[model samples]
Target chain A: MNRLQNLFANKKSNLLSIYFTAGYPELNTTLDIAEALEQAGADFLEIGFPYSDPVADGPTIQQSSEKALENGMTLNVLFEQLQQLRERVNIPVLLMGYINPIVQYGIERFCKKAAEVGVDGVIVPDLPIYEYEKLYADTFKQNNLSNIFLVTPNTSEERIRKIDGLSNSFIYLLSSSSITGSTLNVSTSIEDYYKRIKGMELNNPTIIGFGISNNASYTKACEYANGAIVGSAFVKHLAMDDYLKNIPEFINNIRPRS
Target chain B: MKYGVDEHGYYGDFGGAYIPEMLYPNIEALRAQYLKVLNDDDFKAEFDQLLKDYVGRPSPLYHAKRYSEKYGANIFFKREDLNHTGSHKINNAIGQILLAERLGKKRIIAETGAGQHGVATATVCALKGLECVVYMGEIDMARQAPNVARMKMLGATVVPATSGSKTLKDATNEALRDWIGNPEDTHYIIGSAVGPYPYPEMVAKFQSIISFEAKKQLLEQTGSELPQYVLACVGGGSNAIGMFYNFLDDESVKLIAVEAAGKGVETGHSAATTSLGKEGVLHGTRTILMQTEDGQVVEPYSISAGLDYPGIGPQHAHLFKVNRAEYVSATDDEALNAGLLACQLEGIIPAIESAHALAHLEKMAFKPGDNVVICLSGRGDKDLDTYIKHFGY
Candidate 1:
């Protein structure tokens, strides 16, 4: 069964999802990172497409994105890497980016190519669910791709379920009100949010993202629900290159001690 | 009186599209059809009629006796204050909506800062019975509640943008995002004269009608076609462009643009373009804008909410660089005083947007018989809320 379909069934193990920008430390390292992540025990990996304006990201991810852009990443290059990376990695590789670049890239053509490239899903941070349904819902279903939506703490109960219903896979729960890598800890706020959604009868499962920096932070997130997403910290490690090969040890330090 | 845009869509050096490659096609499409549709005999006749009957134009040019005597100079106010929707925003809104209808665009979207543009857009959309959606910043939505309520009552959806800095620039970004998503059916009703190519040109043309009327009024009053000096405020530089369009080539006339010096130009809180901004690409074209070394857009601050932009219109940029126009900056306190002075002397409330222009008259020597015409852009009723908040009035 699909990861989302499994949630609807009896088994409900907390899923571990990881988000990392494509072409971060060096160009053409996307497939290697994807293979490494899946082996290191990640359930799903969101591949961020670098954008000029990323309003919701924290400082860590923002720096990572800038580095990715500096290394000269483009949509065409990302697509090429994804096309090749998807063949080697079995886990669902979700493409995440802002709407403007994709809109300029041609939505229908992008979806058609995603189908041919082995992308399981796509998450656009800025596109509202209502607009997606009215405009591009068919394109996603046609491309055999799941459209992921996000639910924030400020999101109402009814709105959460509505978005969850629209979202095919688990909804991406934005950890805090601000961007990623913000100094403020999202623990209490995130915990309260997890508890609130736990009772709301969500249409799909939820994965926590943004602000999962260290092992203590990651474990605190896992305790609340599904495996927490580690974006900025991993991107930070990758940016330093020498420490990237040591990611397996980092995962061991964060993963279940067993 | 002539009320048409100039050949190059400039009021001398105050208007032009300074955009980049990404926006070129959209601008080109609009440019190709704008003049043809705006000039169609039927379009002009209907537009002129609406301006007269609905908006109540040819609005009286009232002489501010007390203001003139106090300042030791004559001041004639072009009362756009009596227009139906309360500001010069409606002038462009009415024209653009008419243009959109002519272009066969099904829906219209607008971005507003101080809410004047959105209200005007919503008012026109309601009149035309077309679907309208206005994107505004969450902060603006909160601060400009009355306008938001007005928009909703007019049957336009107000989308509160939560992304970026919650202000006009962010709202514009959101609206642009929407346009990129639904390009086929949407006509972006740009609030001011900044955007990718044709928008800056098209909006300036629609706004040009202001100067066209001012010219006739000034000529009749002074018995001359050219005044010694003409002045207006700059945000996206629309009102100034409108007032300057016909007078661009009138070499005898001096064009002066007043910019917002929120605190001061040296302080970060100023929106004074020529004083601080460098030549850079913003909105659609290359213009003077405040930016970082890496080309990131900086948030602008100003006491006048309308003038809080890091960039100026491309036409203004060219004018500043070519030294064709005289540019001045007014402090926030200066604008407030001018707002009070106009109200006290003329008994006509002007919008804060227009008061920035009024503030500059104090800084210059209006030599006897200089024949200066200052545009009284809009009424102050909508800004009463802001006035009370700012002064505890």
Candidate 2:
């Protein structure tokens, strides 16, 4: 079984997931960040591979991607950095990025590399469900790597069911039909949409992402889904001067107080 | 031959909405409402009226007698240059603005290369009283200062994209990012028959009026509604697609798409998409684009900023693949000379992009009385500096 499946099986609710850009802040900071995030009690970590164009990202994440590229981050460098990652961090790690850079890197090679690096899954927002089904699903399945699909409020029940069928790890329930990093208030419509998805009882689990900032939003999101993944907000902390020391504090702020 | 967009939004193998999930709702809403809104009687009436009154449509299809005498073929110029914003870009702009209004969108965002699309979009937004934001590459804004001023004068905020090559592709990336961020209450009026699904089909249908009017005007001027050959320059291929849409069914008509070969096709500065391109997704659609082995988009070059784009529209890619249209290219020197010849012989100065199609005429062995229609897609007013620089005024 995949590490993602094991993690989800063990944790039923409020599973905290944190997303931070790989090669961000510094070129060699990914391992440190991952170790720090694991120590901070994050259940899962989404390591972003920066691309020149990230359509789904907002200013904060986009800036991180730019900085990562300027810092001479590439697929080879990232893969090399992750060579001994499993030795330090045991939590499930998923690589999140746009499809173009991966496509450039060769999809098969990317999947193989992810598996070799102990990555459990990937979140490519731009790769449509149809594309993955036709071209990459077999490779992912063969490599024992899961690929997460995102759903918006506008996704029809039929498409949602289809996406749920395709997704192995979880369906990323976007809080709203907007990009990441926006200050979002969970409106009644959002709550209603979440309820609708929960009612569907999809085959795979669900995790909410996008516009999830701070403890309140994260807690509110957990009421409706398996858990929540905080990206920009967590990434914002990583950009701070004392990110290594601050990671645990930030995670504790989002996670329930022990 | 089925040439229209399929239900899946594909033009054979080329088109599909490959946007991020964040943009799914916006594109989905657009896909759902575009056809219904287009078919609405009121929508048709207003679109037609705007084309007639504001855009000065039913633009004359003039017989270039001097050009015909010189080239040994009866050439007709579909005067898209006579439109209000000085190109066929205005046709789609007016259509999209009206559609955006009908969709209850409060703000409009667009990306431009040479700034003709920006000017056209800004003009429509000004007329409709919509808040407009236009993303343009820093380099393009500098090169096309006049059109940039025109966009600003029409109350559109022109944001410079400083990333990447600082060209059309980068500007489009910035605009897509903006759209993703502000998905609600903002409609992206893509300037060409490119990007995702509904955009390529929508812009093509809107600009189809160019050929729609040309067919009637050609029948009135000459006895045949179908010309032997129809030629237009391809950048993102909006003007060419607009000129070719109506004639796709006519198997007898030979369609020629001329791409910009900046220095030359082999000089690494050309924008000849079909000649030196591969199938890939760029700006949301799977199209033929100049790309590296690593799939990083190659920066294309041309004297005409409008033709400096690295990719062609997905529909154009489909057409080229299936051999429905012949794709050719012309160099900068050749195009400048052709622009000069058109000015001297036809009393009309064409935009440098349009001159590429005119330059292709020099290579063809046209038979006597061969009825050829060339889409004079834009006027040279905005390209005056480039023309002056080349010809020394």
**Best candidate according to lDDT:** 2
**Cα lDDT of all candidates, in order?**
0.74, 0.90
Model 2, B246-314: lDDT tens digits are 999998999999999999999998999899998888888888988766565789989999999989999
**A180-257: candidate 1 lDDT, tens digit per residue:** 554427666667888887777676766776677667777766666565677777777776656557767766766763
Query: What is candidate 1's CA lDDT for residue A180?
Result: 59
Candidate 1's C-alpha runs over 4 A off are A1-258, B1-25
Error of 1 at B190 (Å): 0.5
In candidate 2, stretches whose alpha carbon ends up further than 4 angstroms from where it belongs are: A80-88, A156-158, A187-201, A240-246, A249-257, B162-165, B181-184
Model 1 agreement with the true structure over B170-202: per-residue lDDT tens digits: 787667756644555778899787875567776
Question: Second chain of candidate 1: TM-score?
Answer: 0.93
